[model samples]
Target chain A: MSSPPRDAPGAGVLRAAFAVARKELGESFRDRQTLLYTFVLPLCMYPAMFWIMVQGVLVVQGQKQARDVTVGVVATAETAEAARGQLALDEEGRGRIEVVALDPETPRDADAIAELIEGEEADALLFLPDGRSEDDPAALFFDSTSSQSETARGRVVSALEGWTEELRAEAAEARELDPEVLEPILIQTRKINPSKDDGALVLSLLLPILLVVMCVLGAFFPAVDLTAGEKERQTAETTLLLPIPRLGLHLGKIFAVCATSMIAATLNLLALGLSAGHLLGQLAGLGDGAPKVELPLGALISIAPLAALFAFFVSAVLTGVASLAASFKEGQALLGPVQMLFMLPAMATNLPGMELTATTAWIPVVNVSLAFRGLLVGSASAGPLLLCAFSLTVAALFAIWFSVRLLSSEEVSLSSETISMTRILRILRPR
Target chain B: MTDPTNTSAIRAEGLAKTFHDPQRGVVEAVKGVDLDCRKGEIFGLLGPNGAGKTTTLRMLSTILAPTAGRALIDGVDVAEDPLEVRRRLGFLSGSTGLYPRLTGRETLRYFGRLHGLEGERLEAAIARAFDAFDLHAFGDGRCEALSTGQKQRVSIARAVLHDPPVLILDEPTTGLDIMASSDMIQFIESRREAGTCVLFSTHILSEAERLCDRIGIVYDGRMLAAGSLDELRAMTGKEWLEEIFRELVQRADAGEGAA
Candidate 1:
């Protein structure tokens, strides 16, 4: 077999870099488990996990709606009968309380009545006289800490409303006054909460954390494989022997990890979509009716840039840190801190009152988290979000430059010998 | 300065490297080494561990920069133009490995591309390597699955994929069985026949004796001697190569000049 002339070789830096990236992507997908981690897990696992969670919450809520609470009356038997009769008039069962009578001769001791509630004999105790005129209404008391007690109080209020209506009617007949004149004004209100409001709070809490965390996680394995894995396999020097620049080599590796990250995150987004159906199904139990839980399409589309930028940001960091280690296990250990670095900032976004402020927009991982959350909620301002993007770009550039510098130097890359601090300082200080 | 002609495939003069370890202060890894290997010849560097055999090869292959002095690869200065030096060179070591996730064929293609070979030419080059190394049967298998000998062949194939004029192999047979070692010797001889200079290090004395057109004995990061087998024996006044090697190491350890 004859060999070709050595005078010329095909393609240059960009092409070579891409070749390296292609090889990495191909190799990653070939291993079934790696592919699963990269694609399948995010697509299937999160949805199933979220479905189970939603089911659990719905069951607990359903039990609460059907619960019955006992109401203990501190008044005489006739007073309790009047309240029961008033409650019985309403057929909707809006009053979910069971009535129990007390002795009329007993002192109206609020403390003794409270004892019944404290001892768990009754959920709540109501205090009222056996008889009272329309102008002198009975007073009612119940424990606030217990949900049962709270429910009983609501039922007592409903019963009082009925007695008040009858007294007003009698007074209106005697005076020959219009019955509607008793109420001079009407009040109306609107609320935006999880039950009646859209799932804005959940969206705010989950979006950015998932975006940043999944982006980091997506880059994790690929970054490790390319850096420390190369060394452990004894292929680092061999790979570097090519004519391509160290920059090309690093860019190739960073590109591959970033691509994997985006792929993983996008799959994670799809998983979020699948699990969203179940999440919305639980909202229906609120009886306020929930529109389908649609992740703002704009937010989903915007993630492409944020996820890519984030992938670029963290992949460079992960690769550079991974390169510091000599083996896969050691790399994994070293990267524990790197993962924490990303996670802490992302988790900070979930804190209430934490917003995309001017200062926070320049805070790397934290900025991306805030900006991403804002984007999802359609509340992120353009100025701060762009600033956050710029900050991430700078960070990504620095990490890649650092990685390339480490890779380029013969003292470090060749024998896996790290430069001594004094040597590095000498280069830095340049005395 | 050992080059006798302009066609020297490798040349070196006073190559020096010193590493600073805090506890040990200055650790001189290589001290002013000078040597040369002519085209179509095999040069063997024989020494024990930490004797600078690897350090010297790394310098010549442009993997490490010299603290002082310089070397040339097939006429390209290693220090002044390291990329040019790397282009004309094929480097391998006992520690160097093939990608376990890639097949032998893919390994050849990747290195070929890195070396700037592509298209039909790259295919031809890979095919030539597969045929020359007799690696067809194991070409499709991932590198990790191949036997040690097969892996070694693929490693060598990848190294010379660009048809470099110079080959630098450090302890090429450090962990090979007898069969694999012989196969490596045959491959090295073939490269010499093809007019490519082969510089290698080995622990196997008989194989070195059989393969080297000339041998350089390095000890304590210094070149103690360089000559043909008969010439080495004559200089040391020893009957056997091992005796000469032992005498040289002892002399170097004793901090004495050549006898």
Candidate 2:
């Protein structure tokens, strides 16, 4: 038979990369483990993790909401009767001053008082010492270590002050004592930091950071497998030999990895969404509510493509470098460091006060993280987005070029010689 | 005696290849060899280990480029357009690989596509190869699961799936069982009858003597003799081709150049 028509060697070449992409997608779908790990597990894992975190926050908030505690009033009959009539008036809907009156003559015991704090039964103890008079103030004994106890201490002090004023007024009416002399000075304490009252300070930071983590974690396995795994299994040699273009193989694998990551990330986001109600209920004290966070539809759509691009760029660079490495073992060894480098920028977004910009947008790992954070906090700037997209495209192109060079390099293709310590020393030693 | 005007299926002119090691500098693996293999004939290239026979075959198959000179596969220069040369030829090395994960059928189909076969043609070709190689029993079996002989048969099946006009098989029967070897020998004879120019390389002299229409004695990268077995025997003044081969290679190693 004669040679093939020369007019369209280029057409076949163009389709080659797509063909490889298709094959990679098929292989990924074929593996049951890949599906479970990339898609199914992330879906279940993120919500479960979020729920646990929220549950912890909620338990603390619930204690904070209790506001006041019941304290034992151990005092004489005369003091007790006077304390009752003079007690601070409890208002409805105030969620305060829930006093469970204890026996006035009960002996003071540390263990019993400790049990009240530990069991969360009471907040404080009003200890009326023996032979206490109307002029003498009753000492409030409460655990400062307990947050509830501290709150209850404030309530007891205010209630006693009210009672002291009423006694002063009654004494003034009956025996001409001065109410002003009894209470001369009043100190007003106010909160200094207004931002603290806005609620859920960590929400803005944690959400963006979590989103970035989810994206990276989701894509990690598939990206490495698509490139390095092929080399390990020796399927790469057979793949390269195919009449399909090398670019097609690179693009195809990138798409597959990207798709896998996107699916995982999307499911993770959904899990977070479903658990949002519970998280809000738990953190209600921290903010007005769970900050009413939702991934904007536009942001979600943008994320899908962005994630795909990120996966492609990552896979291309890693695979390209791995292909050039000495052997399958060398490829895998090198991939870990490459992954770390990619993760560094994203991890940086988790730091307090770190912001994304156009200049830093070109920095690979950081850019993806920053972009993800911006999307999460509803402040994703267009400049940074465009910059990251450009940087990713450039990186992708570079990786493709590198891969092509690797493919062409006879030494890389034929020899699996790795550089060990011995080899390195051979280079270092004098001839 | 063959017609020169019909043109050689694989023609090598003054072919040379030198391998360079960073530590050892340059080693000349092949130097100044000329060969002409005719159509409808089996040309056996015989030499010991490190005799450069494999290198010669690799150059002809366009797997490796020669350092100097040229190899043509049916008139297409291997150096200028290797894919063209590859399209016309099928190559199988003794230790060439089959993907361990791929089934025998998958391997054949993949290679068939690589050689540019598609649609009905690709399927038909693969089916024919499966039938011809008697690989139906293990067609769906992964390459790693198959026995050594079965793997070799699959390799051959993949190599020849495109049914190229030229077949360059380098030590194709090296690790085969006696039965498999016999089957391969018979396959080559039949392919020759159907007009596929067969260049079969081996270290086994008796196999070469039995199979080749023309036998070339290669020593240290040079073809010492190229002719029918009888012609080679006549040139060395020996009764048997094996004796002639021994005498020529021995003489060349002893610093007596070819006559």
Candidate 3:
């Protein structure tokens, strides 16, 4: 009898690895928990969260606008008329201010003003001496403890400032001078990259942290399931008995985990991208003038390689760390702290002046975050970006190597040995 | 080097394993033990719990490496070329679990692919496994939804999917009902008839007596005596296998006490 044809050595190993990955992905898709975490949550969570936030802000703003306040104007009859006109209502007519004339004999003192405020006769008191010069500042008093008083104080101060500006302009016109000459320094801001999308800026600031978190989360469950879950289910021995190399099996699991992480990140980015413009508009009160939140497809495409490498690195690290555990719950306990390690570094991008640089490009999660931000904002340089990618590649390769070694150990694969720092250190050390 | 002419499908020489625990210091789980099983033979490993039967079988199946001596699966050195040895051997334990999310058919296909079977050949093997295990009734259902007996059948199908020459089953009938246990025994007998070398461990003396062509009794990680039922009875001058086992264990204990 003739024997079947055999694949070349490398081809056979690769085929087995691919088969393992395919099986894992199939199982993951079938698992309801994995599906919920990987796809549905990311798709719905950002939009729902943003919607709730936008609605909350709008509700609070509406409530604040609908409130009205009374202000006592302790001013001369002539100035009182001007104050009435100035403080009648806010520009949108949403904030109404009732201007009441105080008794002419009323004392112009803090105690008297406090008495009027406390008596509920007025929410705020504005005192303007009859004979005060134009240069004399107006005294406005209101109780900070009361929201009405705070609102009245804001209206009166705003009206008085407008009144002062008008008075200054009149004074300047009477002196035969142009009001514009009063301000010599007019700061006009300009952007070097005017084409930089507002959406991209928001994404740059926001996506990095979200990407790191989502990527970690995406890899988290699968890594635990494939390793510790397998052990707990007593399937680890079955997998270990396969004729393939341990490295192949490890690689297959990592590939499946990386795919899930990337899918989650992409879905999160898509959800955030779709909703960020409208959400930011509502939150910033820009309304109709909100900048269109266009995803920087170019930057996204460019950063794909880095994102993939980061996912691979995270998957490998999670897989190896989780494998130390003998049960699914134990894996979660071990990985929960490890997640903070990735998250805190990604958050470093939110710090002001934090950017991708020679030093930062070597840092793991921070480098990827800053790089993603820079790429989106059109600020990334090729040299540092390349360095960052190289560093991640090396780290990812190292993580894969370490994970394969860990999986290859019989004690780890077969025994429910108590995890220890010494054992971990031993694994980390070269054999 | 292994002799190609040797009929032994499973062979071990002084196979041993030791574990290092932080609190317990050094502990030897399997002291030097030796065994041989020829093709078309059923060798039963009889031992009490914690007697190192599982550990020994693990070494021969290439799941755990032997810390001392050597093991060979179908003439392939276990430690030297574990992957090749694995290809020649099918290993199953009571605890060998199936993927809960995968259907039985999918699980078979996965194992088949891992064993380098694919395309038409893979499908053919999977079909045959499904038929052989009477799994068609529930093959499409997720393993998590299957009954215990059904899952065991699927696990057995998975082990034998690669058509390996040497089969190492560690307490295959453990946790099974009377009917399931009988089915498992019948399957082991079938494998022996098909010229597959079967080495299984069981603490159930009745099972060893009923199914094993040659029984090797193990105690405290040491093999006490190995022979056919008649040879063992004659050696111990006992009529029943249970009495023979007790006599052998008592003698080993006496020897240890004297030492």
Candidates by TM-score, descending order: 3, 1, 2
- Residue lDDT tens for model 1, A1-431: 13334443323557657877888888777666557777878877777777787788777666665567676666666767876666545445243667777665545567876787788877766667645747534666677887777777776687678778898888888999888787667677765544312554456577678878888888888887888778778887777776765566778888888888888877887678556645765755544365446655677787577667878888888887777666778777878888988999899778878898889988888888888778766688888878888888888888777666655555445435434556444433423
lDDT of 2: 0.68
Cα lDDT of model 2 by residue, A142-258, tens digit: 898877788778767877777666667977767666766656886788655343222223344544445555555555555545555555554544454443444555566656666
Worst 10 residues of 3 chain A by lDDT: A1-10
Give the clash total for candidate 2: 8
TM-scores of chain A, one for each prediction: 0.77, 0.61, 0.85
lDDT string for model 3 (A160-205, tens) is 7887788779878999999878757779987554433766787788
Model 1 stretches astray by more than 4 angstroms: A1-12, A31-34, A68-75, A79-120, A123-185, A190-202, A283-289, A409-431, B1-5, B22-25
Of the two candidates 1 and 2, the one with more favorable lDDT, higher being better, is 1
- Where does candidate 2 clash, by residue pair? A16-A244, A16-A245, A17-A248, A17-A249, A21-A252, A199-A286, A200-A286, A345-A366
How close is every model to the real structure, measured as TM-score? Answer: 0.86, 0.71, 0.92
lDDT by candidate, in order shown: 0.77, 0.68, 0.84
Off by over 4 Å in 2: A1-11, A27-241, A244-288, A293-297, A325-327, A419-431, B1-6, B20-23, B219-224, B238-245
